[model samples]
Target: MSFINFNFEPSLQEGLDAMGFDRPTPIQEMAIPVIMQGKDLIACAQTGTGKTAAFVLPILNKISKSGSNKLNTLILAPTRELAIQIDQQIQGFSYFLGVSSVPIYGGGDGIVWEQQKKALETGAEIVVATPGRLIALLAGGKMDLSTLEHLVLDEADRMMDMGFSDDILKIVNYLPQKRQTVLFSATMPPKIRQFSMKFLHNPEEISLSIGKTAEGVTQSMYSVYDGQKEELVRHILSQKAYESVIIFASTKDKVKALYKVLRKEFDIEAFHSDLEQLEREKIMSNFKNKAVKILIGTDIISRGIDVVGIELIINYDTPSDPEDYVHRVGRTARADKEGEAITFVNPKDQHKFVRIESLIGMEITRNPMPEGFERGPEYLGEKAKSSGFSSGGDGKSKNKKKKKPGNKPAGEKRNSESGFKPRADFKNAPPAHKQEAPKQEAKKTEPSDTPKSETPSKYGQRKNVIDS
Candidate 1:
């Protein structure tokens, strides 16, 4: 439906019109009405489903209507990348509305910390912060939240996974119990529901497309050994000149190694958890501007990145958690645009990939290993699925939300008993739609054009990149 139906304040409406946001996404359509009514809510939707705007739009509208304009809303995010991203969306959405926000995340030096502290102590109607640094600010018991009318827990499930449950609860203790609370997660595991119950008062619940990949994502995989993964990455990059690509591995070492190997032939950067905040931001700026064409990082970035026109996502290492596979693939095919995802599955990761397959209820087309490489594994198939692998990643146990039945596309089958299956021939999913890179002159990255890493707003904003 058109955004005009929401009847937002004129200033907010002006911002939406200027930004060219005329229609609402399904998630936004369902959640915005509930939020505008000033009700607490628990929303679960896949990444890139406009989850951020679902709440941000209503919150901005309410702020415009009330005109309090002072520490009215507090949003907690799992990572600095996300905090910055949410703050940016607020910036864009509130441009004409005159709503000011401060992003408080850690990893910044003294100057940044002081700047954030001043903003928190003085003004800014909305504060989007990471749990750790916010907790640090609250430790002095000087930061006040008694005036907070709204509390948002964006990417709620990711916070739980990062062991921020206690920190979040502590922060909640500082907020007004009478405030409206909104919790948004990509998944609704039991723990998240329990967490919600503790604070969100009789919240309105909305869940959509759980455990399903985006419709526009063309999914595929390559079976390879550890020794053969580098060559495979090279071959894939050579085969197609994807303008913007993200390669996800499990560790910083892997990201760095891949960057070293591919730098000369391709304009690429490695994004892990090791770079300083400025270094990270500079890399991200370059990547978004198309100064660098490739980004390599870990699971930390999957949900935080929201750049449009991303043509490919390559999993350099198999993500052990099935849901992670969903997030990684979600990186591409955003904004209802076609894109592709290719996973490199080594023999050791076969069972993990099997869990992924079962979760999505489809078989990904496994391309033959390039001409001369040895075949990776037997792909134990159903046997491996039953061979006692935990659905969570590694030794960590994630409380996976049971797959809810999602609406399948036309010509796709709905498996009522399990999850919805897109089609038996997902193996033959078509290549992503072609879009040439932005024609800007290439800007060279510093440090001899070598090792690195970096998120944004249209359905152009969400994500962070780092090196560890």
Candidate 2:
């Protein structure tokens, strides 16, 4: 339906017009009216369905009409990436109105802390913050939200996953008990439903199907040995000279390790906890601006990043969580545009991939192993064996004749780092820099480890967000 049906204020309508936002998305259509009616809501919508605008629009409209800007609303997000994104959207959607917002997150320069404190001390209609940083501010008594009119929990499931439940409950305790509370998430696990009872007041529940991937995504998979991963990455990126690509790796160490190896061959950067806050922001800005073509990062960016026109997403590593697969793949094929998502599944992660397949309700096209590479596992589903860092495996290690016990003193425990063996080349990769590390986020001080960035879901069935 058209946005006009919402009867948004003239100023609000002007902002939507200036931004070319005409019709409402399904979630927006369902939620705007509930939020406008002052009813609490719990919405389940996946990434890339215009969920941001769903809550942002009505809140802005209501806050604008109220005319009093005394810390009217507080939005809690899981990451700094999402907090910034939501605040930016607030600015865009409230352009013609008097709504003001401040994003409270940590890890930036001291100047950022000062800016957040000042904005809250004076006046802001809305405040979007991460749990950790917001707690810091509240502990310091930096802002008074006793007059707060609304509270929103965006990416509710993610915040719960990232260990923010306690912090969220604490933050809520500071807000007025009578305020309108809204919750939005991509999934509704048992925990989410149980947690809502604590705060929601007869909240209206809206669930659009869960684990549903977008139609435009073209999804595919590859079963390769551990050593074959880097080679597969090169092959995929080379196949279509992708202008904008994201490689999802697991941890900060992995992100850095991958960046070092791929730097000379492509325009790439690493996004992880190691970089300075400004550097992270700069890298994200470059990606959105198309100056940086390839971004490799951990799940830190899995929920909130929203860069459209992303051409490719390579799950340099598969995610343990099936829902994350949806988020990573959702990055591509956004806004009804087509995109591709490719995943690399080693023997150890084959079962995880299988669960993802089940969650999405379809088997992904399995691309054959490249000509020179060794043949991979035989699609063994949950029976897939987890292998060590071996160069070649026919995926039948379980059938091999049991090897005689290794030479060792009787009853002597395996050395401290037993199963954690690494390739000789990457053995010293992580520790080499960690031992000599400078103290802080110097932007380059990093200890590289094994890689794992699995971009979030969107469609032609491939690509990335912290919230995209």
Candidate 3:
């Protein structure tokens, strides 16, 4: 049915029409009616399911009916990016309804603080904020929520993951007790169920696609050595079908490094917590507009980003948490469009693969690396060699060196300088910078001990003695 069939205000309908959204998503269709009736709700839906609109629409409807635009709603989100995104969507849907909205989050200039203070002073219709900043403002007496008629915990699971349960409780203390509460999440862990019980009053549960990946996403994995991951990613990008890829790395440092590498080798950008707010916004906007071909990101982008037409998602490294894997791959295949998710799995991360397999309840088909792509492990070895560093047994620096046989001599030693006996290994060990020298000295000192006849060591001979 059309959005008009939901009987939204003409102004809201006009805004929806302008945005080309004619019909409600399944979650919205099922949730909006129940929410408009002022029932508490616990909604389980994947990202890109238009779940935001489900709650926002009914909240706006309630505000319109009450004719109150004075701090009547508070939507708490887990991240600055998500807070801003939800604020933007609220503005979009309520453009003609005169709903004043402000996003209060950290990292923006003091200007956000000023804007937030001013909005609260002048009675904003809705306030969307990250829990920390909003709670701080409320505690500092900069904002009041006593008139709040609705409370929304957007991305509730993420909030719980972010350790915001205490903050949520603190914020809820200021909210009116008889108000509607809505909790939305991509997955429903037991903690989330507990959280709902604590906050919601016999909430109506709405679940769409529970314990499943988005149907539109085509999931696959490439089995390659760690050394080939980067080249394999590049080769995948070279394919005509691969456009606007979001590559997920496991760490912030990797995100920055990968972004730098991709920027040098191809047209790409990176998003992570380390970026300045403006830089992050710029990268997100450019990527959204198709000005950038690739985005190297960490889990920061996994929860809130809603860019459309993302052709593929590349897991540059396997996600440590299976839920993060779900969110990362969910970035693509949005709005009913078919998309692809390719994960790069090296042998070192087999346990992680098993965890993901168990979580998703499906095998990630192993595909061969693209032809001409070099393996990552071998490439790192060659790189180390080229840089005059030896790739030791563990593929790290050889200069670090292993312990010599007689460094401790089976006894501890006393340090006269400190008047205390140190461990024999410590007493005989060279200084940090002299570690390499000991290796050469040990080689020379041990040559005579080498058994030319391949005789066993004393421990091996002792085994025969014991047996006799």
Looking at model 3, residue 71 earns an lDDT score of 78
Question: What digit string (tens of lDDT, one per residue) describes model 2 on residues 234-350?
Answer: 656655556788899977887888887666456677898877666677888999998777889988877899988988888988899999998998888778788888898877788
Which of the two, 1 or 3, has more TM-score?
1
Q: Indicate the worst ten consecutive residues by lDDT in candidate 1.
A: 459-468
Candidate lDDT scores, in order, read 0.77, 0.77, 0.72
lDDT tens per residue, model 3, 7-123: 877766877898899878999999999998889999998788999999998888777667775778889999887887897788777766766777777764555456556656766
* True-structure Cα RMSD, model 1: 12.7
TM-score: model 3 vs. ground truth: 0.79
Candidate 1, residues 342-430: lDDT per residue as tens digits?
A: 99876568888888988887899888866434555455666765664343223122111222346344333224332322223221221
Report the candidate with higher lDDT, 2 versus 3: 2
Candidate 1 yields a Cα-based lDDT of 0.77
**Candidate 2 local Cα displacement, residue 190, angstroms:** 0.4
lDDT, candidate 2, equals 0.77
For model 1, the stretches where C-alpha displacement exceeds 4 angstroms are: 386-468
